[model samples]
Target: MARAPKDHKTNALRELDAAGIVHEALFFDADPAMTGVQIAQSQGEDVDAVFKTLVTEGKSGEHYVFLVPVACELDLKKASAAAGEKSVAMVRARDLLPLTGYVHGGCSPIGMKKRFATFVDETAQLFDEIYFSGGKVGCQVRMAPDDLALLVPFAYADLTA
Candidate 1:
């Protein structure tokens, strides 16, 4: 029998279950030293197909979630426009924990304390399947991009360069 994830009740997994989204959770020997790209590469996945959850603070002083490919960078201007804010800036790691109930690398787009407006990178639509943090290091959840869209009330936009 396989062992359960260290943080099994994470907002990410809970949201997926609540939405009835089908996904396969994959756990690997996590290396805290590795980046998301490194982790995906180690798992034999295309880096572009791996999505990273990033939290940004809008000019209005509210935080929003941006789901983009690991290999791409978040376009703050586009994200800001998508969120209907004047500007968007990356939130520091220390500030993220209290806001999302998860640490830096472990943050997931789902199950946030307050649902902020979210944006999914348009590039994500090109992939049939994408991998995202499973609310913890050493684990990831794979699901269809469309399914993820349903789970997150996010605007699909060209928010990545």
Candidate 2:
């Protein structure tokens, strides 16, 4: 039997439920033209506490997912090192849906189409609860960093430049 994901209901939220973690979902306009920082600003959120999910493909053809604060940039060198890859580059935007089941501005580390090695920038450790896309546009999930770890096994690394 196929098992369903846990609480809050969106696939991403379901993921948290299945993982036995608790979190709240925040909905907002998921405008393609809006940067993560812009979305955070519209919600009156501290930009640093809102994170974006990035999809990258390693030199060897494996995909990796990274989460970093909305206002920060991912340092390729640091990401590559963290993933144990010689190099990794962002997957083309058009490829995201077919590859990760997410659109460019709405990717989430929790409910990707397939599990990939995931990393969260070390800065997220600074917050008791942080926000990230909820596997779709217009929604964000807020949860303690420790709870998030239960859904996506990730390491804390210097992913931001």
Candidate 3:
């Protein structure tokens, strides 16, 4: 099937294009209740190739972002160490919109309201390209890990357990 021209551009997708990073947006049906795992599974995508964006607040009130593979859990201990904080906690769902300009099911590390310290799971290094929410629930953007790092200002670490 032929893919349609990119019309419904999200901030995330626009940022990618502005940075000169090539990416493809794949559309799928997802619910607010669906996790990254569920989205990948329902879309017949390889779980290892899909990532979830999570936001956390450090003890110093600094916000941090992590992109981990869909099938894994973010290791809080590892996350804290990566962020140079003694502890970190997920940002409240209610705060996500105000903080990142995104809702619970559609947060993307790219084009956030403010630049948060961002990190990607070391496993992302294993894939040339990975899929993450295109700042929306149904649009998945697939791009090279290197490209993502360049556009999002991120580091790679052992973020998942």
Candidate 4:
């Protein structure tokens, strides 16, 4: 029921609206002090149902987006293999803003300036619904995994343990 503040607009949210994607936005204490796992716990949601967006660079110097459950870690090897790349490394926090047009902790896979090779952890299919950042800290959007997959350009792969 919580919606983003009127003054704070993000490209991700705008894209969702433009696409007619139905999503519920929720807000928690804007505590930059907590991690994604901590926020999920405080919200009384299963940690596994919460996902975090990660940006990685392939050996080819291409950026890729990885969405994995908060409960699991992104296996760079699996991700690279899925993308048919040699290897992958995390993008530095400082670099994320310019690359994705989103700040760290608020980078959603939606509304990127340009679509990169995106990968969704196959484990995400296990959940009926999942929560992801609404392109801003303290704000989250819940939607069906299938819906997300449909809206975002991504491939499903076993990128997690």
Q: lDDT for model 3, please.
A: 0.87
What residue pairs are clashing in model 2? Answer: 6-14, 6-17, 6-18, 7-17
- Model 3 over residues 73-124: C-alpha lDDT tens digits? 9999999999999999999999999999988878989889999999999988
Estimate the overall C-alpha local distance difference test score of candidate 1: 0.84
lDDT top scorer? 3
Tens digits of per-residue lDDT for model 4, 1-161: 35557655677777777888888777766778888888899899889889999999999999999999887889889998998999999999999989988899999898877788888888778888889988888788888888886678788899986
Native-referenced Cα lDDT, model 2 = 0.87
User: After superposition on all CA atoms, what RMSD does each candidate show versus the true structure?
Assistant: 2.0, 5.0, 1.9, 1.5
Model 1 ranges off by over 4 Å: 1-3
Q: Write one digit per residue (lDDT tens) for candidate 2, span 1-161.
A: 11223332566877777777888778765667888889889988889999999999999999999999989999999999999999999999999999988888878898878999999999999999999988877788889987887878999999988
Q: What residue runs in model 3 are displaced by over 4 Å at the alpha carbon?
A: 1-7
**Which pairs, if any, clash in model 3?**
none
lDDT of 1 by residue, 1-161 (tens): 13675656677888888878899777788778988888889889999989899999988898889999888889888898889999999999998888888788887787777787888888888888988888877668899988876867777888887
Worst 10 residues of 3 by lDDT: 1-10
lDDT of 2 at 11: 69
Q: Which is better, 1 or 4, measured by lDDT?
A: 4
TM-scores for candidates 1 onward, in order? 0.91, 0.91, 0.93, 0.93
